[model samples]
Target: MSRGPVDPRLLQLSGPTRRWTAVLAVVTALRTVALVISGIIVGRTSASVITDGTGLADHRAALGVLALLVVARTALAWVEQRYSHRAAAQATEDLRVRALTVLAHRDPRTVDRAEWRTLLTEGTEGLGPYLTGYLPALMSTALATPAVLLVVWFLDAGSAIVAVVTLPLIPVFMWLVGTLTAGRTEKKLMTLGVLSDQLLDLVTGLPTLRALGRLSAPVAEVRRLSDRHRRSTVEVLRIAFLSSMVLEFLATLSIALVAVGIGFRLLDGSMTLAAGLTVLIIIPEVYNPVRQVGTRFHDARDGIVAVDRILTLLTARSDGDTTAHPGTTGEAGGRVSEERDAQDGQGGQGLTVTFDHLSATGRDGPRPRDVTGTARPGQLTVLTGPNGAGKTTALLALLGIATDGVTGTARVTAGPGTGPRLTGTELWDRTSYLPQRPVLDTADATAVGDTSGLSLGQRQRAAVHAELDRSRTTGRDLLLLDEPTAHLDTPNARTMVEALRRRAAEGATVLIASHDPLVTAAADHHIEVRP
Candidate 1:
């Protein structure tokens, strides 16, 4: 897929990072100013300790000054942390919402199991560390380091010069390690995705594999993928550990050099005892953020890469067609205006679909073909096809999936004014697909305010009834069902069939695709597939 403009995720990052950086910068500057005041107090107190030696009045005053500075710095640091976390959390939430929106618009059939699994598992999982750990580290390096260095320069020019010269080396080394392992890290991630994909495929298809005596084949392939993933992981870990060690050594050596310099100056009386102790305490503070930056660099790199992959997934071409709003005209093609006008004229009656020469396949193999059909307004027409037939595909094609590459002359009767055809947004507005295995997530169910302990059949029936009730307010009515009696045994299937018949009698178009003999026998209208 060709990428468009800048990634939205990257654009979203800019605002939050700016807010967090500003807050952290203020905190760092305040802390540095406090340190300066504290240093002056320390100097004056030291002089009093030497001259007065045992005056209770002098000791008490010094203690009061020192205590105030400590409390102020502590409070500011706490506020900084609280806001930083809030920024991180909000950014992560935005990314998650954008990801879901992208997924919702995607062509369902175009997404393979591996891609879906990667998005669900690795993609979302990367966001937490990226925001909380990596994002703040990046901001701290760019913001806090400079502020700390400025303070150090004011206090001791020599120490400031050393820090300025050495800090760049840490990032340089970090970049080198990152560059060397870039290819390997990507390869490792790819292998891990493949490993997860293989394992999942095996798990979902286990029953079929056992039935067909092909379990060993998939099991062997899964082992191979797992071993490859394990080897790649080991290589990545080895490089990461070595890089961390090198970075640690360099940063420690840099701080040690500053400490050595201050000690030498203190011995020669070039620096006062108060200044020496302050420099000793402040040197580590200057380098501490930089040290943290190095540690979190790996996480940051991985997260950015993961984000890039997510953007690619999100922006991939969808099977859905472009929508034309009422009374709007521009670039949709010839006869588009007429179609919109037709839909407008027919307020009660919405999109009408006619299928010709439709054929589809499951994951296993190609299904039967030549499914000709039409769905009229205010009429329920149930679709029936044999096992391994293209019934589901025919319905999906009507809804604009499995047929994005084709253009057709299929007419959509939108009220009295006939339109060009139904595709994309037009098809979507008139359609709602219920798959054979309607996924019932506990979370999704709660989200829509449907929280009854209902079985699959009961849940679906209630859901369909609720939709029907809502549609009754408007004059448009239609419902599509795939294997409505899939989970029901013989007796229950009969009851559901009678219920569907009643819905059809109430003037709602209910299309059902089922392989059960009971469903085929009970359907008011049937389209059979012969192999």
Candidate 2:
């Protein structure tokens, strides 16, 4: 799977935003025209005032036109600012949605939650400068630069020539600075991601750290990481400042040269005062867009890098095979078999899950390998395994939750002709899953009897009870519980298992991954997974 180029991918995702940006560009061009007209009126009026004692009353019409143009320019500038921000916001929203969709579909273990939070929040928002500042300036340069150059040319060809020749120098200097700082910018972004991850990890595990008497242990480590990130940020900023300095210097030098040429031509009586003044006024406008691009480039770099990361994730395929059938394990480009198996019965009382050559690879550890099993409805199927044996992975794979590094055939044999295999949507619709470490929101915390006041075990038990109640009301077809009894005491754990058993008796397919002897003892079918 090819990720392709970032700009095209962004454009494809944000069609409406691009249209808005184009509209913004047109408004910007109009604003530039107003500025040029105002400059021309000012130049001609000044020349008139100098040439004739009665020029003030004689040039009253031009002064009025200048005033109106100023008002129009101000109004256009306001609209441009508003529309540019709106466009940037809309584009960022699109990127966030796409990135989130990819995250939701991919295997959870493969994703770094903290980094994802940073990417979706701070990283996506970083695009504001790119869209609102950089893109607008780029479009303005494309539209305004040439128009201004032509106006200057008509007034004085020599000044126009100097403007044209020097305009390219700003972009050239920008390119040089960008080339030199690209690596540092990337490193700075990476450091930020790491810092975000570490801070999030520390916050999430604060309770555990406190309980283990190591609450303050990570403080020094965090400080060190923070300092490193600070240094990286400063380095990137320093480069940005240097780039801006170079662009400003080049633009200023070019404008000064044009000013000098126009002054000399005026002194030699080769150019009219009005024409010289107009060329002098418009020269700086020619270089303004290019210089703006260089300044905004600093802010846009992070967003660009984030887009690349997002594209990489979007293009990645699951480990099994890209072309394999949804429920089967096969090589890439393999076709889904059309032949129906004998087990492809019509809609029945319950679903039967079958796994053939079931296995999954882990990011940093070993996983279950080649494990074959069947889990029938109306029974408790307990997966017993040592730690890191992929018990949770197996359950997740059956629900199509984490299929990235999984290679297996997991068929949920239910209703109709070829056995209605479960898609991710169907699985989510029919199943109630309880993860080992659930992050509770406000409602969940309240249901769990104020999580802040409860012990971990009490909170877990309350959460389970709440979920069980929901399952009963919704009548979910399947229940996937990972380490359901992990935080509970023996008696509480037994009671929880009994409650689960009741759910299974009510015709829900219940699968649990546990290491507890009590849970395995109550299972209707027990399967042990080995590393």
Q: Report the number of the highest-lDDT candidate.
A: 2
**Candidate 2 local lDDT, 1-531, one digit each (tens):** 113212655665676566866787778789888989988988887787786655577877888888888889888888878887888888788778877766755556777886777777777777888787877787788888888888998999999888878888887788788777777876776677888888888998998999999998999988988898889888888989888888889889999999999889989999999888877777788999889988988888777677667755544533232322223322111123323343433333466677677777776644777767777888999889988888887776666655666676666666421455654344455667788976566767776555777777877787788778888777676788899899888999989999999988988788889999999999999877877
| Pairs that collide, model 2 | none
Would you give me the overall lDDT of model 1?
A: 0.61
Alpha-carbon lDDT, every model: 0.61, 0.75
Query: Which runs in model 1 stand beyond 4 Å of their true positions?
Result: 1-8, 11-65, 76-90, 206-221, 266-273, 300-302, 312-339, 343-345, 356-372, 378-394, 401-403, 409-411, 416-430, 440-476, 513-531
TM-score of each: 0.76, 0.86
- Model 2, position 281, has a per-residue lDDT of 78
Query: Which pairs of residues collide in candidate 1?
Result: 321-424
List, residue by residue over 1-531, the lDDT tens digit for candidate 1. 112212444554446655665676677667767766676576556755665685547578677877899999899878866776787666556655766555544335555656545644664555556556665565556666676677677777888888888878888887788777677767766787788877777788898989999878876777788888788768867887888898888888999998888878878888766666666666766676667766775665555566676655544423323322222221122122323423344445544555554554445554445566666544546666666566665555554434433223223455422553443344445555567766555544654566566666766655554545445654434567777778677787787777767766765666777777787776666655433
